[model samples]
Target: MGNCIQKTNRVVLGFDHSSGNVSQKFSRGQKKDNNYEKGNLAEWQKQKGFGNVKKTMNPPQTPSVSGCLENSHPKSHPLPTPNPISNTCHRGHKKQPSFLPLPKPEAPPSKHEESSSIGTLQPAEPSLSLYSSSFSCILPMPMSESEILSSPYLKAFSLDELRKATANFCENSLLGEGGFGCVYKGWLDVETLTAARPGSGMPVAIKKLIHSGFQGHNEWLSEVNYLGRLRHQNLVKLFGYCLDGEDRILVYEFMPGGSLEKHLFKRNSPSLSWARRIKVAVGAARGLCFLHESKSPVIYRDFKTSNILLDTEFNAKLSDFGLAKAGPTTEAQTHVTTRVMGTEGYCDPRYLTTGKLSVKCDVYSFGVVLLELLTGRRAIDETKCEEEKNLVNWVRLHVLDNGKVFRIMDTKLEGQYCKKSAYVAANIALRCVNHEQKYRPPMTYILEILENLPSNKNLNIY
Candidate 1:
């Protein structure tokens, strides 16, 4: 159901389904709509008249293209009713795959388009099915490594058990390759997230890291520490991890929509309209805002498209906490200075030079990602000439140019984005990436702008 991320270049964006996409109605401290917690998705969908699906033992099949989120609640956002399809998979396990095929690599940017980070899109990897269940799990930290075996959140798995679940790490189950190593798709119980036989429980993405890298171990521990400690609708759920001697693996709630990276940058994927992009931004912002607002604030050093995973409903959930750092607790201590660590293009420019970090550093990175969504450009595009390589610089210049804001937009949008929202987004992004960290708006302020973009300010075509 809505719990799994549709791994398509999908759901139209903004946590658009498998990750935590915030239902738009709630203000800070307000309770989420209880209707969203309804037990039977098929029953709820029928009552709401969503998707026009029929009642059955298995859930209805979801669509490849995630539907749009309006200035409304989950009940009000008109779902894209997909045409009916078989609800059962081979062995009768329910498989609701909503993957759409990608188009050819877009034509490389012409030299004339100097300001837009319009690098050529690459072909997406093979599509995989995104599975979701109605159940949700809670995390309880382990007291020690021995207690990890008993921890409710960080479950321990034996090498033999993991090997069996992943079918000895078969190549066919490979989901995607990255710097860390290979990620295989595996099966687990819906509630416990413990290993289960195929078709017996829910599906999960198992990330197996090469045994030796310091970064891998640190990142794995970081993910376990943060995701294990914090619980939020907009943050990815880390069900368990394995530390079997030389084998180190992390288990996460498989995000079928993959990363916001795939949707915004991959070729052949359906384009994210203006509204959806705004939704995704707000969703990610909520996750960051939660961290900043915590009793012990956390700075998510890496806030980029790749780390934002989407669920089946295109709800955005923040994943990968390797770079998250606790903020200064005392009011007298303004910032925490440390060795700089972050993605190449999305790092806060001030943090990069000063090696001094603050909650605002995250705001800066978020500004970069926001610009990416607005312009459909990479933060750093080496393909572009020296002058146009930096997205923020280029966008900041163009955003200030009256009547030229469209020059920074993604061409694939086909002029369908809301001009007013796009302009507001650009203004926010500009403020976020300001050279001086103090000039950046707090995440809460950013949240307000995104939430009210379509409604608070009059909507005018760009």
Candidate 2:
């Protein structure tokens, strides 16, 4: 390993860091203007080529949460009684009758037995199966709008409060925009949880939904349902939500360091050091591990660099739960069939080809993110040559060769990381991106490996 590091260092020193230009440079995946102009949803769908599938893709009416939509004022409306038989999909699709529902597992023996500290470095007991009946007590049932909004962890913010906090959503307050809507930097009073004067209150990221966008009220509710109930150190904190009339919005704790994507791929931004990179990887792994280990596991369908937000200390938190889905409930169930929705390049090929979603699909995407951290490259870089455009393919071609493994290391790292540690990290990433979904290790195992990597000094290169 010593000799290999020496040889690789010389070659790395001569490698050009500024050869290819990043072609697509958006803060988020794709940016849309925050124009609030009303447009016809049918025409918009037609222009986007969704006319052919309009029948199957029509948004299902959400009677459970429609009561809040009727009130335009900020005053608290009476909580509407939930529908007795509301088992509709989180996305606006009606539940199909073709699939039979599985029997619910009996409650766990004790709540204390199932609980574990998420912040700890130790892995869970290996004897406990992830899908065993003991863990079924945590499976989340379909939540009603009243139950979702009434979560003690989440506050119900009125539209008027958000408007005042964001200075009426002025251009200067704009943070960033994506397919769902625009996020603006806003201020809120700490103790009272009310709108505060700019520069005088705690900062927050307010996401206002776009009515015309493909994503709408359903996605908003999905986010509220998940983030409002789930709380973890590595998960982004949802301050509250607004559902006045057709206006839909979510308020989140502001991340000072912004996204990992900006630091890793954006030009002029400071490069993340080797130690900071490892820290970020571990933080993100912990977040994913927490989700997987939940009594009712959750599959974060969309796990990408842009969705990993960092705080002032660079602690990573998973954001954007709109596309999140609940994992299989019973031990007999291996996967859940759902619509394929995730970013390209980072998406699992098996999930993309067969709409069977599982926790391992997230592991595959995590591998892509690990590759990005290792090589300082985008998962899909259109600017690069044909062979190098896909990061995973390029890695497979080069990483297996012990002599060439260092060549894929981010040039900005300046050969500062441990050579053996780098080799171990690379192998971990390869195992994650394995073509066979079952071959992928669970997030717990992955987190254990990452947790040990930063301090381990005796690892062999091979």
Candidate 3:
């Protein structure tokens, strides 16, 4: 009986081990076998502070061993399957895809699985530029031909040419000396480069001034300032100037006939014909009118025949602007006052007495010159007898008593003067010499009467 009981217990233990509930299942077989396993589990649970309980594994099913083995790669990643139906066709297919999507990629290895994979990847390095790090690869700028040529200021003449033309400023080439400096006659090459400074077609008179710095510079500038800027038939023309270094020279057209004084009073030359004399007087009057009544009035402080220059054509130009004074503008209330310095006989007595010079002073001097032209006599002559010594006093005596006045006419003229025009001109002279400044007519009035003088050259007295 004892053997049979032991055998039954073994059978019960086997069944429990084979099949059991998760809550009450035992690894050993039968109820007795279950009690033995539970007793061992209870002892371990009591030590761990928990009741005994059975646990079961619930895992997702994987592919069959054969399918997984065929698809498995030596790299531990499954090989991608190629489907002919899904692959894009070769060229010349009727069913061309409008848009194609990228093929799905294989999954990356699990972190634990990839730990022993290929060599470790280095951190990505920063990108470097082929050109400069700070600057961009922009193109260089281009320049125009005109821009390059026009960049520099041009010179009128080359330094070498100027040096040669001035004869290296030789002392003998000197024309006239003045407060500014000496004037030199120079031969300038007409085909020079100063904004069309070509050959002057003839030698020019170059007035050069020594350096005195910029002190009183504007006044120095004013000396040739108007001459350089003015343009008229009777006015002198300034070609150019040199303001470089210690040289301040003004270039002008050379007038060949010399001045009116050279021809008028010089003993070696015969007196000008009445026709030429009248032409010169009219031309000079027109020049004075231009100065006195232009946009800017100019008073030629010295208006005697000496200052009247004659060109080759015998065209008269009023030169010697050194003593000229500009007229008053609207903003200024008074005309300029300057120290008295003028030829004695030609100076206006009213201005000499009052030291108040005006445009009328020039008109008074013009009248005196007219008298000189009429009588062919000097304003103040020392060769005559004491009674006739002073031309003004003698003229005053004769003009008051006209009977013997014709005797005082220049012997060279041989009575070649219009009697009626001479009387009118003498009356004009008498009016110009009036003691009262207001009694004298303006130069413009004298100019108007002289313009109307009979042009018939044959009406003469002998």
| Model 2 stretches with alpha carbons more than 4 Å out | 1-142, 401-403, 454-462
Model 1 residue runs over 4 Å out of place are: 1-151, 401-403, 455-462
Error of 3 at 55 (Å): 99
Against the true structure, what is every candidate's RMSD? 21.2, 22.8, 58.0
Candidate 3 deviant stretches above 4 angstroms: 1-163, 166-184, 189-200, 208-220, 243-248, 330-335, 382-390, 403-405
**RMSD (Cα, Å) of model 1:** 21.2
lDDT of 1: 0.64
Looking at model 2, how many pairs of residues clash? 1
Per lDDT, what order, best first? 2, 1, 3
Best by TM-score: 2
- Residue-by-residue lDDT tens digits, candidate 3, 1-462: 000001101211111111221222110011223323444554443343333345342211221111112212233322222222221222222221111111111444455433212111222122422111121111111144233122121123344455566676678767666445666666754555232222343566666665652213443344455553344445555555555655555666666776676777888787776666767776677666656655456677777776677787687777655556666655364445554545656767666544566777787778777777766777666777865654555665565433344755566666676665565566556556654555566665555455545544646555
Write candidate 2's Cα lDDT for 1-462 as tens digits: 010001101211111113332222111011231221233445544444334445445442322221112122122122222232322322343321111111112232233432432433232343443212122122244458777776555678988899899999999999998766799999999877799998888899999989885457777888888887666678887888998989899999899899999999999999898778888988898788778876577899889999999998899989999888999978898899775667777777776555678999999989999999999999988789987887887786665322266889998887777775676677668667766676577786666566656343554222
The TM-score measured for candidate 1 stands at 0.68
- TM-score for candidate 2, please give it: 0.70
